[model samples]
Target: MNHEKLITLPCQYPEEAKNSFKKLIFEEAYLLFIVLGTGETVNKILDLATKAAGSNQDPGMVIWITDYTVVSDIIESLNDPLNKLNDLDNTYAFALSIIDKVVDVIKKDENKLDILRIWKSFQLALKG
Candidate 1:
């Protein structure tokens, strides 16, 4: 994997990040979709992230941040008077939505101490 290249993919905006992700997926056809398309389960996604991080994809960095963090970072980086994410890609929007749902589930789980704990458990389960 090309760590430098993937690490350089801008996460400041949704459009750029999505385009970069799409580019990487296209270039490394066997990196993500290869595993995801199969019935590899959640580990496939985590494995892809690790593989991409080892390469130039920086999937770990992308997945590490929470939905609120991503939104805050994007908003804070903006200079326009109206801080809107209208230019973000559909993939980013979809990701945020999924994270939102995960957040909701964690909220109702009652067993988890916090989001970080939930995330850790989720990762461990995937690894297992």
Candidate 2:
């Protein structure tokens, strides 16, 4: 990632942001998967996602991941007001939006189960 750019709120460069997000989606897939799974990892994931999505003030790319757990319990926890989405920070809103979409998909279908498990395994490898 380019360290030269100091991320603001939403990124202003849509194309650049989209491309950057796409790259991160692939490179950080395992990290993302693991982060989304555990309650402990949520904070770090929120931090990273906030940076990734709020760098400028532009929601350029909708970075999608398929490793999200389909359990409503997990979804509920993420949606809770204490999850930081209710904070005063504008960046948190953008990050929450991305997470909300991810959880939505997981809540919708079982067809993604296999892919979700694969992502979990990939996450574990990265952890080790």
Candidate 3:
């Protein structure tokens, strides 16, 4: 595929084209065809992740306050409340913060795409 032509393939609508390509390829692979595809789900997640990332240029500067401050300013507010959930390890806190960003904590990549394809197939098979 020529680079110029390939780039223009989605000049105006990249995501719509990508999802269409995923559906076509998954359902009509040369060697094997998948019964179902989760490209849409993955795309939605990716969109949310992008929005979350763009909305926070400097997330560290985000204002932190107690939800109950309105009820009682006396209560000591922990800016890093997630720290309490996983005191032993902060990985959960890190992940939780990501999840808090509009239910988007992860992005799909090539590796996850393959897994999503198989998982979608399994889900469909189970439904039947």
Candidate 4:
């Protein structure tokens, strides 16, 4: 893998991201998975995944993992009327930036990303 640019991964290119994720299981002898989260719970989860994979780390694949739950948690916490980040306009705009990124990613592989949402957070309930 000579294309060593700074990959802020869970890559925008769906095909490449899917390929990179699968390629190592057979090709590389060992795999280490890291799940970055806040504090101890995350620590435990990371320990479970990495330790489960065990020992040989760094096959150079960096995957970015996250969800809307973080943002939704912030909104729920700041439901107070006087909170600075509670401003409707700014919050909506911030949300739209995330939407824009999703739009760009979907343009790459709509079906695959939709399938990703099926396992991740598609929120079909949001429609009704």
Q: Which candidate has the top score in TM-score?
A: 4
In order, the Cα lDDT scores of the candidates are 0.31, 0.32, 0.25, 0.27
Provide the lDDT at 39 for model 4: 46
Q: How many steric overlaps does candidate 3 have?
A: 0
What does the lDDT come to for candidate 2? 0.32
Which regions of candidate 3 deviate over 4 angstroms? 1-38, 60-128
Question: Tens-digit lDDT track for model 3 on 17-67?
Answer: 444433332342211111111245533433332333222222211111112
Output the lDDT of residue 44, model 2. 41
Clashes of each: 7, 9, 0, 0
Candidate 1: residue pairs that collide? 1-55, 2-55, 2-56, 3-55, 3-56, 6-56, 6-57
TM-score of 3: 0.19
Model 1 agreement with the true structure over 8-32: per-residue lDDT tens digits: 3344576665555445433432212
Clashing pairs in 4: none
- Candidate 3 pairs with clashing backbones: none
Q: Which regions of candidate 4 fall more than 4 Å away from where they truly are?
A: 1-11, 31-40, 47-128
In candidate 2 the C-alpha lDDT for residue 74 amounts to 38
Among all windows of 10 consecutive residues in model 3, the one with the lowest summed lDDT is 87-96
